[model samples]
Target: MDWRSVDAALFDLDGVITPTAEVHLRAWAELFTAALPPDVAPWSDADYFAHVDGRQRSDGVRAVLASRGLTLPEGDPDDPPGARTVHGLGNRKNDAFLTVLHRDGIAGYPGSVRLLDWLAGRGIRVGLVSSSRNARAVLGAAGLADRFPVVVDGLVAAELELAGKPAPDTYRYAARLLGVPERRAVVVEDAVSGVAAGRAGGFALVVGVDRGVGEPALREAGADIVVTDLADLIPTA
Candidate 1:
């Protein structure tokens, strides 16, 4: 991966660093299962890969509903759960996620943690870049709050008025915050939209961690390389 050329590394939160993607997928399923009608196509993991993964909560809500030929108003962020608005559904999903998170705390992937330790040993700056607003909570839950000095999640993105993944703005912003130029930073991601964003940002390299999204899709989405696990990237003596 031309590690010698990289000055910083940016990682997507849920699938790449930790298994929180499972929690998020369950939340999304719960929201859509209750929202979709009996005759309509049931919510499936495919919907998650296609519309929800790597998107901001509200954007994901709109995309999933659009795929089902359903439209909801862009309700305020404070909209109550099950209120039948974009933000409401997003909030409902968040509620489900928080419930699971609190019930069962998260942990980072061992291989990913090993890579982080290896990168630290090499003195490379690392940052967490994610579309999820709950990134901070998840990072803390995984007990990795200290590993990343710079984080550009949904909250920071909104505060900076940056666009989310599949747009490249968030990834670009993370690089800037880390004081690393686009050509000197590496982006590691597990979602198609995230791969596309890294590609659009013209980073040094985009590594795709295939959790569920297939290799061809990630490669087509602009991943420079694809591996089943981050552990594979570590060199052995």
Candidate 2:
């Protein structure tokens, strides 16, 4: 796909920019398994790949509970950090994720860096658009926070009342932050929900980095092009 028409790029954080993706998966697994009742089976990888990977924290908790034929009250977002409700579960996951991140410093995806550099060199404005509230911290730790001049992360999403991935709001916000129209921006994602959001936003290009999910899955999710790595895109400079 030709990205020439795109003047800006919006990127996801966990899997797209940093190795925190694995940390998220692990934390989810831990939280889900611990939350399961004594008689319930443990959380599986398929459960993660199917229900939670790309969703918001509260959404992820709800999805996993549904998988086990369970339900919980839609607790308030400010529900004190550990109250046993949906928000509580989400907070627990966040705590676990932060622990892992602090222990293991962020790792950058070489392919992603190459693509970001290429875009920057070509004068294409770039922004980091992620559902994670810790997007800034992750990028800062990885020494990449300065790479993108504009950042529209979970905090921005909350402030703008924008829905997360699969709703097109976050990507649209990022594009807006870059002062580019949706049709003139590219959204690069690794999650099914994120690619769908990009496509729904009518971006000039919806590129998918199929890190774990196969290429066909990404294509099916509305990615214009699926590449194993962003390095495949030659540097415009």
Candidate 3:
């Protein structure tokens, strides 16, 4: 990789920098397992990859329900959990995620930290762009909040009226906030939709981290390169 040409690195919070994606998967499974019709297949990881990963929370709930051919009202964001509406399910999943997160805590991948340190040594600015509203909490719990000077997450997206992943607005916003041009910014992500967003935004490079979401899917979505871990990108010398 041409390290000199890269001015900034934008990372996805869940699967890339931390393993909170697993916690999210567990939360999603719990929500769907209890909520889906008994005849519907039990919620699985594949459903997450296809419909939930890298999407806004409410949007994910809507998509998952649509996949089951079950439609629900677009409930208010403040609706109580399990209210038989889209936001309710979204809220429920968030609540479940928070329960596990606050109970057990979370941490960043060692390899990811290595890469972050490498970038710091090189003066390459770093930012975080995530679909999850919990990005701040996750990064804080993982003790990585100080690494990123710029963060663009679900809450920011809603406040600024920026589109979510599978769209590039959030990434673009981060790059802009980091004071870097897209052509000199690299995006690291684990989800197909995220890589697709990088591609759509015409960033310098879109890096795919194959953390359960397969390499082929990420490549198809336009990842310039794929790696199993961020440490693999560090200079061997």
Candidate 1: stretches off by over 4 Å: none
Looking at model 1, which ten-residue stretch has the lowest summed lDDT? Answer: 228-237
Best by lDDT: 3
The 10 consecutive residues of candidate 2 with the worst lDDT sum are: 228-237
- What tens-digit string does per-residue lDDT give for candidate 3 at 117-178? 99999999999999999999999999999999898999999999998989999999999999
Better of 1 and 2 by TM-score: 1
Question: Tens digits of per-residue lDDT for model 1 on 1-237?
Answer: 558989999999999999999999999998898898787789999999999999999999989888988888898989999698999888999999999999999999999999999999999999999999999999999999999999999999888889888999999988998999999999999999999999999999999999999999999999999998888877785
**Residue-wise C-alpha lDDT for candidate 2, range 1-237, written one tens digit per residue:** 566787888888878888787888999889887888977667887777778767788878888888888898878887865687999888888889899888888868897888788877889888988888888889988999889888888788888888988899888877877789998888888899899999999988898988787788889999988887788866445
Which is superior by lDDT, 1 or 2?
1
For candidate 2, the per-residue lDDT at 87 reads 91
Residue 85 C-alpha lDDT in model 1: 90
TM-score of 1: 0.98
Candidate 1, residue 118: how far the Cα is off, in Å: 0.2
Give all candidates' CA lDDT scores. Answer: 0.93, 0.84, 0.93
